[model samples]
Target: MSWFEYRNQVLCAESVSLAHIAKEVGTPLYCYSTAALKANYEEFVDAFRDRDVLIAYSVKANANQAVIATLSACGAGADVVSGGELQRALAVGVPGSRIVFSGVGKTSEEMSAGVAAQVHQFNLESKTQLESLSEIASKQKVEARVAFRVNPDVDAMTHEKIATGRRTDKFGVPIGEARSLYELARSLPGIEVVGVDLHIGSQLTDLEPFKKAFSRLAELVNALREDGHDIRHIDLGGGLGVRYRDEQPPTVSSYAELVDETLGSLGCQLILEPGRALVADAGILLSRVIETKQSSERVFVIIDAAMNDFLRPALYDAWHPIDPVSEPQPDANRDIVDVVGQVCESGDV
Candidate 1:
């Protein structure tokens, strides 16, 4: 199913050769497979076909217009965090009703823009944000459909920087305090409590964390219904991990089954925001090897690409597979060298 494969001893993005692309567009460029993008988006659609689900592609992962438009053509909505992201989604003809504005620090201006666009839901992280949106929407004379992103406090068992559901993280309000906030939201003007939202962390490979969070959310939904709130949506923010190396992420079908098992009885529209899972494997960073040098201790392979160009390795110590554009012979001698960027920083590896 990989679109990037070797054909006739040349690595290709779909049917186009990478060498041809590099020769034409030059190195240090990004190439995305339109077919791969469509296939990834369709996987979600096929998984949740039987349910009332919205697979909102998280725009922050890969905001390329071509990627967004490809997904949009596949009937994918957008999950945007900032005003610029909202505009980007809108620019691709993604309707306001299909956009979910989600972020921890949404400014007043950003909230106003989201309100003006009439985004489907605003995943409010704090009570002050709830109040701000209420005031803005009240002045604008429109009911802003809102969801409270409650912190489930479950460890996603991923990278610490990406793990967000822990109580100490600054993302969502505590779960115990969500009901009281929902009550406050109902009392406030121009705020319509439509759903509940929670995003535990990114690059999550296991389902236990999700099961724990969704179970708690289900309990809250039952409690919220008892308290006389018309909750119609459940925004389970994205954190599904994709395989960068040896990661066996749960299948989309399995994820959908988990959702059904946890919240199917609630009869609410399910919203999933998946960013990296959709585009991570759909694109590749094509760079040329500038030089190879030997040091007293080790050898290094330098490339024209820098840490600023591709930051995962520099930022998260992330690993990505490196391959030569030309297919090497099976018996070709391999040199163990540290592949690094040309950035002036030591962390450029």
Candidate 2:
């Protein structure tokens, strides 16, 4: 259900006025809707209720402790990329057994920390990392549950920085060599090979890439099972995009339908690592209009929020819907204002 509604011609978040939040928390503050977050989580859970799925909330989306704690209280797991995220997840009562770690360059300290925390699984990206993890596990005398992230080499049809599963990207092991890697992990002394994982890319809007990736992953899973390796989990790492601009994204129900159909009757457990889809629309950064500067060709609305506060716009040239809380009448006058932030760099928000 839609939470925000115009009250007296001003948009509010869950009966809490956005203007009030901006004033209370101060400008450049991030306001999150606990209801929205909970609703998004419940939406996905309900859609995939029949499947053996674990919704690992990706912590990188918005790592606020309150947000993490809220999701944890709702029986959601975490998909962490670094030791910091792992610690944050555990700090908020998200059990280590429910955490899946994914990143390309994991340091020795990070591995030791994750091993200490007893994370559920590690989405291994490279052969070198697999060996390192095995060594760390051997030294710690703990069995490391691992899933080799296979790069299906499918184009996710997203921006370059976010596209991960493409052949030119360095995110995962090539699909052709995934089985061999699984065998190698099985033969390793300290590693316990559990499953296969993949993250094609972020902000993915279409289903062809997902379908192709899942089919390829299913083939490898079957082959591995036939060849005497025990693969039990399939992590289709979340890259489902949202309607940040004017584009429309598949609702959580439709997205789950695609996934459910793709892995029909597969014996392995399904794990979805959703981050942006759950939190993006639930939270928004509010900044006060610091000043209005006029230019020869345009006008700029300099706000207090900077790259430090919300970097998506600057980092990815991402589009975030902006609206003035107390705006003048629409028919009064119109001017194209470039809403910007206070960072001291060209790439700053």
Candidate 3:
């Protein structure tokens, strides 16, 4: 189910040989498959066709202009966390009405820019930030549609660095304190409480955590409705995992079913922010082997790509399969050598 495959005796990305691309573009380059990107976006659209949903591709995943534009052409909106990202999405022809501004730290200038652009919604994280947005929106004489990203305290069971829904995580307002904050937002000027947002974490493989978090979200939405707030949309920030190693991530159809089972009765628009799931497999960092070093006890295959070029392995000990552009014979000899980068650091492997 991947666009990158080995054809004959060479590796290819949707029929274009990786070896040819490296020969032309040089080493340490990123190659993305346009076909794969469109396919991934279309899969999400097809899965949610029956429901009122907005698939906002998270810009932070892969901010390449070509990647964003390709998704935009496939009817994908954007979930941006900064003013620059918002501009990128807009420059790529994503309408302001289709962009959701989200971040914990929003400067006055960023808020002003978002307000001026008439963004679809602002996923506010803190009361002070919410107050700042209200003041800015009031000054601009426009009501800013807002949603409180609530921390459901449900563990996403993902990596510690990526988890954002836990009680200790500094991503969103605590769920217990959300109702009171909603009450305050109701009284604030130039603010419209249109929805609730929940983002647990990134690279989530299982559905139990999502189910628990979404069930909590459902309760909060009902309570907010009883409090006279028109909860029109639910922004379930994306954290769906993909096959990175042995991880068998849930299918998009199954994820859609989970959403329907949890919040289908609410009759609100659903917003999903999927970043890694859509683009991770569609692109590859094509690096050439610089040299091979043999020590007394071990061997190292140094690559032209460094940690600065691809930091996930160094940052999170993430694993990515490496293969030569020229296919080795089925009975070729194998070596237990460490694949390293020329970063001149001990942790460069």
Q: Clashing residue pairs in candidate 1, if any?
A: none
Tens-digit lDDT track of model 2 for 260-290: 7777667778889999888988877777888
Candidate number with the higher lDDT (2 or 3): 3
What do the candidate models score in CA lDDT, each in turn? 0.94, 0.86, 0.94
Q: Which residue pairs come into collision in candidate 2?
A: none
Per-residue CA lDDT of model 3 for 101-180, tens digit only, reads: 99988899999999999999999999998899999999999999999999999999999999999999999999999999
Off by over 4 Å in 2: 327-330
**TM-score of every candidate relative to the true structure:** 0.99, 0.95, 0.98
Candidate 1 lDDT score relative to the true structure:
0.94
Put down candidate 1 lDDT per residue, 133-163, tens digits, no spaces.
9999999999999999999999999998899
Task: Flag regions of model 3 displaced more than 4 Å.
Answer: none
RMSD of each: 0.8, 1.6, 0.9
The clash tally of candidate 1 reads 0
lDDT of 2: 0.86
